[model samples]
Target: MSARTTPSPARTAAFLTAYDALLARWPVQVEHLTVRTPHGTTRINACGPSDGRPLVLLHGGGATSTMWFANVAAWTAAGHRVLAPDLIGDPGRSVHDGAPLAGVPGLLGWLDAVLDQLGLPRADFCGHSYGGWIALEYALHAPARVGRLALLDPTQCFAGFRPDYLLHALPLFLPRRTAARARAYLDWEAGDGPRPDPGWREVYALGYADFPATRVVTGPRPGLDRLRSLTTPTLALFAEHSRTHHAPRVAEAARRALPEATVAVLPGLSHHHLPMAGAAEINARLTGFLAAPRG
Candidate 1:
């Protein structure tokens, strides 16, 4: 399926320039591992220590592990090992040639293979947006392997219906000149400086170009019953300015779904910027939650 609209030349050029600069700054370490899934060889960026408690970080759709750039250092510094893997089909280092595990089961199996390959019996799981959905799926399917779970502005609530993407891309769909200006506006507001790394831009671009299916892989609606069944200690972080207008509703839904879950809303942040905007808070909460004694 084609994108609703083609990216304008100016927008494309701007994106390319930003991407080129990003690659020069943050050079990620890439690893190739094969999973049992039919998707074939999967590539992941394995950062931080291998000896520390394995903390797997998953990024939202249209984003790569680079999204965790700001959080990795803090997480690692706290003595917890961190693993930021590019979702298989996304534009990160991971490759998806054949059919990928689309929904919850597919995601769980893919993650299981990653853990098995790394010789990790279990680890703390944290995901942002789409990653959050996958993280929840893993916890639900393999509760024994997930010591703790953190969901950052995850989707699939409200019966799997959300308009966040439309809102985020609305500016891009404006008039060409207007779109260019809007894009520039975002770049400026986001700090036009080079990204922490260059490869991140490339990875993100690749996902944008190759992984259109990501838009359709929000996963199934676990509903309230499934959410209530999750026994893993969970933390749900919601951005104050989430594109999902029903932020309060979603948060309330999550709280009700996982009655035992720790729910908190970070003020003065949007969906895309939460990973960075709430880095310190997220790190602190995650550290405490993960470090806490588990039954």
Candidate 2:
């Protein structure tokens, strides 16, 4: 099967350039890895000691594993081995020859293949945005494979995307998306920061430019009933200023539904850049949760 959405050659080249440049700046040495699964070959960047407890990182839509570049050291510093995977279809090195939106079964299958290939029976999971949604589904589908779960301003899980956020991002779908327009949209989404490095910003723009909106993976919103029954330990982080969802409502839903969950609303963060913006705070909360003893 061909990819539901494939980047044009030009945009792909540009994104790869920025991606390489960004990865080169990672604070710690990382091992590039690939795992072959039934769905496709998954590309991963591994860090920290081999024998350390496993921690898997998943990036959001229109981004690659590079999303975790700012927080890898914090996770690794906590004596955990980190594995950040470039999710299958959204503008990464991962190959997606099958339908990108195969719903829960397809996603769980791919994740299971990755874990099996890496010899990890269970690992702590931290996901941002779309990655968070994937992590949630994986935990529900194969509860045995997920040890602890952390969601960084995840979208389409506990709450739907905010209307204004959706309206503001509409320009991204225009056939003639330009770098300037894309960057502006990104800046608007990020709201505040030491503006991401120029190269990284361009990479974000090119990645979005290359990816067709139709193929973006928005995981199923398994209702509150299913969420209430989850047994996995979970940490749900929402951005106070996010346009992805009403932060308080999402947090409320998380608190109300998940049996074992801690919901926090990080102040002054937007949906797109929550992971990268408050890296220190986010990492602390994430590693702390992951390090806690399981019941």
Candidate 3:
């Protein structure tokens, strides 16, 4: 599709500048990698022992892999190899030069290629929002590969978006999405609750304004049969003040579907604040999940 093109040089430079500033806060050595996939060249921020337990992190929509700066440190310190890749089309370093993912299967194939390129047979998967959906999909698709699953206020898994959240987020999804509008929408999502880092906030807004998204492929949520049939261990962390879906409702559905999975509602956080503003609690919970032996 025409949407799978490179971003303007100026846009790339500005977005990278802000993205890197937060990335610098990762607190550990990092390696930048470019993996060639059937979809396109996937850019990854990799760190920790090469032989460490492999963990693949998927970033939320425009937030990019750089959004993991807060959570990576804790994981890396615990000796887990973390590879956070910017999704192919959504913006950031990954250039969607190849064909747009044919479908959700196409996206999973792209991830499979990325993992193969990185030399991971299987690994732990952690995702936030859109990223969580991907991880959940891939886990269900190939349960044999994922050791553990962590979802951070993930959207569209067990429940759909709340109308109020969609109403506030409508501008960012429209044809003329801009940084100004994105900033307003983000602020509204945060509300009187905790705000994101000023640096992260800047990059988050710029991602919407500058990067003209080519294709965003979000399919219907996994069917209840697939959710119930899931064999991999899962942890679903919902934001208490999320402007999106009701946390408890989704958590209840998640529990009903995956009775053995751990589900909890984090206090005083919004959906947009995930994997960032709620790092402390999120990191602790994540470390515990990751450190646990696979059953």
Candidate 3 residues lying further than 4 Å off, grouped into runs, are none
RMSD of each: 5.7, 2.2, 1.3
Candidate number that wins on lDDT, 2 or 3: 3
Better of 1 and 3 by TM-score: 3
What is the lDDT, from 0 to 100, of the residue 96 in candidate 3? 84
What is the clash count for each candidate, in the order shown? Answer: 7, 0, 0
lDDT of 2 at 108: 72
User: Which candidate, 1 or 2, would have the higher TM-score against the true structure?
Assistant: 2
lDDT of 1 by residue, 1-295 (tens): 1111223444345444544354334333323344544554565555555688888888877676667766776677777777777667655445555554656566677788888877889899999987888888888899999999999988774334456545555554343333334334344323422222334434454435433333345455686777778899998988776665456778888877878888988777676667776778887888788877866
Q: TM-score each candidate.
A: 0.76, 0.92, 0.96
Q: Candidate 2 residues 166-198, lDDT tens each?
A: 898788777876777779987887665446557
Model-by-model lDDT, in order? Answer: 0.65, 0.81, 0.87
Q: List the residue pairs that clash in candidate 2.
A: none
Ranking by lDDT: 3, 2, 1
lDDT of 3 by residue, 100-132 (tens): 787888888889999899888899999999999
